[model samples]
Target: MLRDRDNVFCFTANNLDNSLSRLTFNSCTASSIPSSTLQTPPPITYTQPGLYNVYFVSDEGLPTMQVDCKQIRVLPQPIIEINNDTLICQRDTILLVANGPNLYSALWSPVHNTIPPFDTTSIRVHPQEDYRYNVHLEFTQGGGCAYDTSVLIRVSKVFADAGPDRFVADGAYTILGGPRMSMGQEYSYVWTPPTYLSSIVKPNPTSRPLDVMAYYVTVTNDSTGCFHSDSVWVRTECTEIHLPNAFNPVSDVAVNRNFGLLNNNVVKLEYFKIFNRWGQVVFETTDTGKKWDGTQNNIELPPDNYVWIIDGYCVNGKRIKKQGTVLLTR
Candidate 1:
């Protein structure tokens, strides 16, 4: 008998006097058996594991009968258990264990370099990419048996890249964006030199730098504890020049009396000129502090529209030119 296995038992009878005889068989621990009383007994099946006994009897033409008995033993089946599936970061190591009774040997398929002792019950794996591992178990003691189980170890890759540089006007904000990754998985973000930035810990932050500067961001994967960094340049644009459309130097003393630069940082004042309606050079000056007071050649000009042009350079070596019309009121 075999434990946890299907066993069949058959019986035969011999008649020495050349006469027809009847045969019968019975078992005390058999799960199933046929129901015939002919010269030969039908097959009997034993499913459970244990000790059993069988009895056989035969009746010939004579008054006497023959009897026989036998005993058998069955063994239990083998069981296998393996660790559950799990995830790991790229280049990360993990231990896998298998349990069973009388485990003779084991085999892991889809061999990898990081996995050692591929034929043992336990193995250490460091996979670079996603993989599915199969474990084959064998039992060679007491009714030998073989069974197989599988486990999956997924490897995630990590990466990070901060996007291109950006330009924004002075005192204006610009959005900073880039790529950030960890172990090809989720990660946290951190931007260095956080001056003029809205937030340093966010992926995309707003920056309004006072001067040109380079920004760096570091990304760390949560799972793998790996880190990567990238940089982006934030350039500052020159300040713009604002010109007055019409300045009344006669009636407006508090404002519009002079037509000149409105802001500072003017490196060089090339020239400032004023023209009348006939395109005549009414007034001109190379001094940045010079202003048009509605007079030319020591005479008060008439109330009319006039054109004014100013050219200069900024501190950043950028050239500037501004032109517009002004009104001289009575």
Candidate 2:
């Protein structure tokens, strides 16, 4: 092999008179020696590299014959494939193992804890970001030549946000789930406790719950087989006073004529008040059955937005206090 090129070069010669017998070893460090009377010269040892020439001359009694230069060429030495390039989720660990024949030493970059005598070496790696691991294997016959291989360990940063806490009226539908970060093809989503939800695999699924519920969502990377999770809550204002957001005092529809709960279930009405934009008290009452008729001091008030407040106890004996705005249309 070119790595350790050592050869013995000798010449065969025929010269009876021994008048002309010679050998010329042509190389980078050119040298020439000759033997007389058809005797072969001592073997020439080649130390360096590249093309070499062996020139020989023979002389007969008739005519002298000389041979041209003969050439020899020499060329540097050039996968202990442990594993192919791989991808994984963050915070996860994987094993990198390699087994090869006649190994003297094996080392991996981005260092890890390893034992000696690395003929067959295996190590565990956990990386946070994308990284490329380079492996160097030195064989016993390498003769100072280095053999190398590499495996790319790509880290996929995964995240899942199940949206902010939600507030929905009882029996009302609301969408769930928020943001997510993932990698690989055919990525999928999963929402836990799929009850009352329209879809479990969708990033944002509709839900209709009768009571408070907590939902969790997981985002999975199909290629890396990695996942991340987060949770959110859906609280229900299920049993309380229901106030109309808009009203028309001059409308023929009786339901749109006044502003108040359609049917009061309040066991104890603490207070009920409505204020204008300037925080002026326009309508105030404590009687649950007596609702506002869009009037103040027996005069019709102008149509505008008004803030309404309620502090009372439901028929189920649950205390409630809340405030909201309502439109007053003539």
After superposition, which runs of candidate 1 have C-alpha atoms over 4 Å from their true positions? 1-81, 99-101, 112-117, 127-130, 154-159, 164-188, 206-330
The sequence of per-residue lDDT tens digits that candidate 1 reaches over residues 3-26 is 233354445555466444433334
Q: Give the C-alpha lDDT of model 1.
A: 0.69
Q: Please identify model 2 stretches exceeding 4 Å from their true place.
A: 1-79, 112-120, 142-145, 163-187, 196-212, 222-225, 233-318, 321-330
Name every residue pair that clashes in candidate 2: none
Q: What is the lDDT of residue 179 in candidate 2?
A: 48
RMSD per prediction, one decimal?
11.7, 12.0
Candidate 2's residue-wise lDDT over 1-330, tens digit each? Answer: 112323435555453555556656543543333322335555554444456666656563446665656665532232364877888788788788765666667777756332333344677777787777677776655354356777778887777778899888643578887644443355688898988898998888898775778999898877667788989999876466668789999899986899875433465678999998899898888887778889888899888999999888766678788899999998
